[model samples]
Target: MNQNQEIRNQLIKLLEGGIAYQPIEELLKDITADEAGKSISHLPYTIWQLLEHMRITLYDILEFCQNPDYQYLKWPDDYWPKEVAPADQETLDKCIAEIKTGIQTMIKLVQDPANDLFKTFSHGEGQTLMREALLVAEHTAYHTGEVIVLRRLLGTWE
Candidate 1:
């Protein structure tokens, strides 16, 4: 495989493994009593909040990749949805599933040979398809790390 394909494959593995290995269920299994709902000292976001935020961010990136005319937005400070808080195991699982689907869709889009990897699309200044693909990987991995940290703090890592 060429450099771009190699990078894309590596990223897919990283993201897939990150989500697969995460103890999301354990962490949110009993969030009300698990202390996961409580704020941590160093991190500003809770495990639940981070998952939701990451999902939204990845979805936005995918949207931009799929639709060049889509307007991208900054990560809002008040971005969490009040109605769908990750307060329970079921909601957390749903969020994970959604994120996994988004990641898969992004990978599929990038893997399409007909799609121009170097074609510029509308992002802040405009980014090539390859650049956007790499950005998705980078962004997902970063947030996945944060999720791992939160899991650790909640004593859910396994």
Candidate 2:
């Protein structure tokens, strides 16, 4: 593999998680909508909020990567979920499905040699494909860890 392919591989690994942290897949497994909404009184967010936020933010970054006509999403407000949790099992399942698809989409982006990984977007402020991928990885890992803490508190992680 050339340097770029090597970098792409590394980026894919980062996006997949499970290195020095729990994979989102593992953390998210067995989580129910009810359990996702259960918030510790002192905590500002529930697990569902975190998962939804991750889905939204990752989608935003993926759009930014490909879309020249991308519009800015209002920060904090647009990035977060209005609902504390999914309304039902189907809703939660859909959220998880979208999250996984977004990850795969990002991986496909990275794997494409036509996309210069280090090339900054013309619409972005010094943001490159690599930077956006890393951002997704970092952001997902941070929130995934929080979910783990929550599950432990809920005594749900098996």
Candidate 3:
């Protein structure tokens, strides 16, 4: 595999491990369903919301990379979910699936030599595909750490 493919594969492995090793499912398998949501830290975000945020950002970046003409937009200044919580198992599962799909699509695009990795995309921040992928990986890992921390705080970690 080439450099891009190798990096993509490593990123996929990181994501897969991060999602699968969710403390709630792996470590705290004995915890009751009702108590699974409570955390000592009372994180600003529930696991569900964090997943949603990660998914949305990943999708946005991948979309930008795939479509050169895509318009760029800034994230809202004060955007937090005020309604129902998205931390439920179903939402988390869906987000995981969507994130996986987005990653795969991005990897395929990057693997194509016809696609210019150095070509600048209009991310408002003026990011290139290479830079975007690295940023995505870093962002994903950061959130993955949050997920693990939340799980541990909630006593759901294995």
Model number with the top lDDT? 2
CA-lDDT, candidates in order: 0.66, 0.89, 0.61
Ranking by TM-score: 2, 1, 3
Residue 14's lDDT in candidate 3:
46
Put down candidate 1 lDDT per residue, 81-137, tens digits, no spaces.
443245676667777778778878877887777777777874546677677767766
lDDT of 1: 0.66
Residues 1-158, candidate 3: write the lDDT tens digits.
Answer: 78766765664554344454542234323333234344345456666556667777888788778776776556552233332254556654665678767766766766676766677765446687777777676777677677667777775665
Prediction-by-prediction clash tally: 0, 0, 3
Off by over 4 Å in 3: 1-42, 77-80, 122-125
TM-score for each model: 0.74, 0.96, 0.70
lDDT at 66, model 3:
74
* Candidate rank order under lDDT: 2, 1, 3
